[model samples]
Target: MNSKSRVVVWSTGGVGSIAIDAIRHRPDLELVGVWVHSADKVGRDAGELAGGTALGIAATDDAEALIGLRPDCVVYAASGPERDAGAVPDYLRLLGEGINVVSTSSTSLVYPPSYFHPEWRKQLESAAEAGGASFYASGVFPGFGSDQLALLLATQSKTIRTLTVREIALNDHYPVADVMMDGMGFGRPLEFEPMLSTPGFIEMAWSAPIQLIAKALGAQVLQIRGSLDRRVTDRDLEVAFGTIAAGTCGAVCTRAAGVVDGREAIVVEHIIRMARDVAPDWKTSDSDATYQVDIDGDPDIHCSLTLGDAEGHGAGRGAMAATAMRVVNAVPYVVDAAPGLLSSLDLPITLPRNVLE
Candidate 1:
């Protein structure tokens, strides 16, 4: 019998927890180690840390120890909203050690060459080559479920004029405080400038998707533009993260548009809120949270995708699970790929393995 691929999961946040669950249950993969960011998490069972049953493998904050295990691949689920300075070096160290990496941390890394700084791209590529390993970044939005999937659906189009992908999420139940309050400026005063408001911020964040879609459609992007708007809460709201006082920022609407020949040929739009009633004017899906893609051309196509377990798991939780699964399912393919940075465009179809059993 073929030996299972040894894997390690980095971090234990929302997405990380899902990766751990998938790895532990997969018959073709073996959970070898887990890297934790918090000292308190050290020595705890990996499964327990991820909100599951004990898996016997203890989590550790010691990077050296985790690297020493020589895991075949690392499922990196660390946060990257503010572009954590330590992320690059950490990824380099792991890649340089010859461990293939699949991550959801840096969304831009989904198609690094297209959006990343040339110097940083070269550095990561060099590290991957030196270690004889590969690196791939992915997530539900910037990864397969949005731009990539939209492109796939566009294959039937005889001619295409424009493409737009929109994510409308009711984020009250999303538990990441930093992402909601800090990164997105949620619960802040209306005048406060959040990271997403900075000029070119949305463009930079959604560049990969824009560029990927353009490339797939064989369109030349001349420029990219960004826009942002927010709404205030009329009453105090309680969410998984914390309380949001009335008069604070409650809803956010942002867009990044890729222009081709003076037209907005491709666009990525996000409509997020702490309460459903906050942004009544903004367009939304019938479901709690939905990703919709519209292709305008010969035989225009429209697709809507909803995540979450309606039976129990909230849409927020389901979105997190989908993000994790997107990276986890790509592990084997990424491990077998040639050493270098890879994008969704380059990877073969990666489907979940041993999932039903």
Candidate 2:
């Protein structure tokens, strides 16, 4: 425990890049290696890929090769399939090789004791037990404000009748633009699937967090539903970043519901859009960017969070990294966690006033 831990980063996407930056800033962690899925980035320096100067860590696509480096811990920023079906298995493989893990994949991994793949949890637990390693996961708005915020509000309630969580975000970008287009009902020639499975869609990303809050509040999820709509540019519309067709307005709506003792006690909503303000019916100001969270209980509570300038939107990147860093730093605690799925509520955690500060 006295020695600095050697760590490997498993991807170089936005989350991965931010994670590498956060890792480099940590004195206790040594970023000895990085893994990228692209062949083009194989020989590049991790620092360069992360928008920093050369840090001597090379990016390689060889997952098995990085595994051979025998890092004490691996910070996985890889997403998608890895998050859904491969997270626990990948953790198990690394644990089997005596490597601990912290990831930004499972956003709601931090709350409610049961918000995970049960079988996967068992696999990770068995592997960790056999190899004496640890695994943890968290990130961004999904990781923090939703799960953590809801859980925090639950503490003020005595006889909680119902819980509602809503998340809104604008001015966000992702590497996967096609997924974004499809999810937003944009680039696609036709609207096919809901936003549930598309990348960069908050609805898809918010599911676990909603589940986390529900489980923490002891609500049994009855059903989950989602929807999406977009406004296509009639003509090419020009913006600061680039020109978009008059159409290109991306929007999504999602909801998850749960029942407590046959009463609908929990509902979560996520809304993502690219408009000046929410429509009049949704009841949002026609002003600058903002965020809001309203918690209704026996006492009836309400909270609103707003972010205005570039700095406000930029805060999300740092927020994402900070969530991962905080969760990663708790690897030792994760190592001692009981078998099976776990959450922030399952552990003794003092959420720092500002995750990165």
Candidate 3:
């Protein structure tokens, strides 16, 4: 703790940009480098990429160059079709270099012990141990709200029946083209199958949270079940990404539940809408995005957390900042944690009081 932790931001897309800005606001951390895959961003200033004032640091495509910097940690936020395939290699090299990593890409790593890949899990642990580093992955929905937040709310219950984490997001404000169209099938016909609708995708994406919460409650998951329901818009819908035809799919509700003690005990569900008027029958959020935890047990507790801006509107930017800060703020804890795969269960999470709205 005597010296500031030198940090590097991997990727300037999405959460990475916000991580760069969040790092600058913290006095205890230093931005050393940024890694990007795009050519146009190769020599751009870090601050410019983050949509802020100029920072002397420049973004680079060189992996070894950043590795050579010997940063205390790296915020890995690069995401794609096969997240594990693209992220694992980078994580291995970073951990092997004795540098810790806080990531938003691999959702399963939110709980290290329950990582989906058994072989890669051992390799990650070995590499981390060899280099004396740690690796943690988290995000707002698949990360904190699904696992840590649900378990946190459970502390108030003496007798537990069922635990559920619901994410109700209004996606109209989010304008990511690839995600909105191809990833979520927002503008596609009912016959189209996007990543969210692909077989085993829901379980792969969400089972970790369900199983993590199950294990914490002293039970093993006998099975994990996934379900997806998509509804079509009644009329032509205009969205930030594109248009949702009247007869095309416009909304989706996906759920993953863990069977514990011969019952469905832990569940993580997402209720997403391209427009507010698209899904009236489904659960809705007060703000643009809401993470609600429902504990159906003794002294049942229902807590609703809505992300909003200063203007009282739930904006997507606020959620992006939160996701970035989740890992950026955890850098100090990850750096001091034991050299291995750390999880929400392993490290003491910190909340910086100085973070802005």
Task: For candidate 1, write residues 147-205 as lDDT tens digits.
Answer: 67898889889987888899988878777788888789888998888888877788888
Off by over 4 Å in 2: 1-3, 80-89, 108-122, 187-207, 222-249, 278-280, 283-291, 306-319, 335-341, 350-357
Q: TM-score, each model?
A: 0.94, 0.78, 0.94
Candidate numbers, best TM-score first, in rank order: 3, 1, 2
Q: List the residue pairs that clash in candidate 1.
A: none
Query: For residues 100-167, what per-residue lDDT tens digits would candidate 3 score against the true structure?
Result: 99999898888877677989999999999999999988889887778778888888899888888999
Q: What is the Cα-based lDDT of residue 26 in candidate 2?
A: 66
In model 2, how many backbone clashes occur? Answer: 9
Clash count list over all predictions: 0, 9, 0
Lowest summed lDDT window (length 10), candidate 1: 307-316
Point out the worst 10-residue segment of candidate 2 by lDDT: 278-287
